[model samples]
Target: MSYTDDERIRAKRRALYILAQRDHSKKELYDKLIKNYPPDLCEMVVGLMCEHDLINEEKYTEKLYRAYINKGWGKSKIRFELRRKGLPDSLISQQEEEYDTEDFIDEIMHLVDKKYASKLDFSDYKSVQRVTAALARRGFAYDDIKLALSRIKDGDYDEYDE
Candidate 1:
């Protein structure tokens, strides 16, 4: 489809406006611009942005990973989010490999503290169920959730310091 030069210019302007607000994956920017512009125009605009480093997939991926991590998200959840944003598996795996089990456990613990007010009493079956479900919903691994629950239940929160 042939897009008018005006459409192309509008697409570029819209892309920069959105990028000024936040970083976006190439696909994300295309999807947003294509809502009002032709697909071809959107693609061209995204290509231009990429060529100029205005739309860097790697930079966006890393920034997004760190943001999710700071928000107490587990790797599984963060991976799902990045995938949904149209990030390639290879890039996501690179960031995933950088973190260890301890980092994930620590994130889960921080989530528990923040969400449960650091007063999770796993002694109560209901409390255990609630916290466990919460962690699972956050996309944490089964083993990580299980270990975290056991530690919290045993009042061994200090063990996560390492």
Candidate 2:
């Protein structure tokens, strides 16, 4: 079905409005516009948005990667969320490579110190298990969580440097 020029304008305006609030993946923009407009129109608008640099998967991926990392999220969970947001595997992989390996470990340790440092007791099996499960739910691996716990137990992690 052919869309009128006015409808086309409305679709474009709505797309811009959504984008202005925050950056969205190309697929995200398409999904939102497709709800109110025809598939073809939404496709056209999404295509134009891509062509004009209005929505960039790489940029969005990097932004999200940095944000989640700063928030002390693990790589596995970050990758899952990026994929859910419609980011390509290549971009997500590239973003992961762009950061140093130490950064990931540091982030994990930082999370432990900030959130679970006090209640985590290696002597208490239940306490240790609870902290491990919590970190796993946050996308941290078992080995990494164990390492962080050991570091904290050994008094190697300094939580009061702030």
- Give the number of the best model, judged by lDDT: 2
Judge candidate 1 at residue 43 and give its lDDT: 84
The best candidate by TM-score is 2
Candidate 2 weakest lDDT stretch, 10 residues: 153-162
Where model 2 places Cα greater than 4 Å from the true spot, the runs are 158-162
Q: List per-prediction Cα lDDT, in the order shown.
A: 0.83, 0.85
Please provide, for model 2 over 39-144, each residue's C-alpha lDDT reduced to its tens digit, 9 standing for 90 to 100.
Answer: 9999999999899999988889999999998877888899999999999999999998987656665677787778887877788999988888888888776777
Clashes of 1: 0
Instruction: Report each candidate's C-alpha RMSD, comma-separated, in the order given.
Output: 2.4, 1.7
lDDT of 1 by residue, 41-99 (tens): 78889999999999888878888999988977888899999999999899999898888
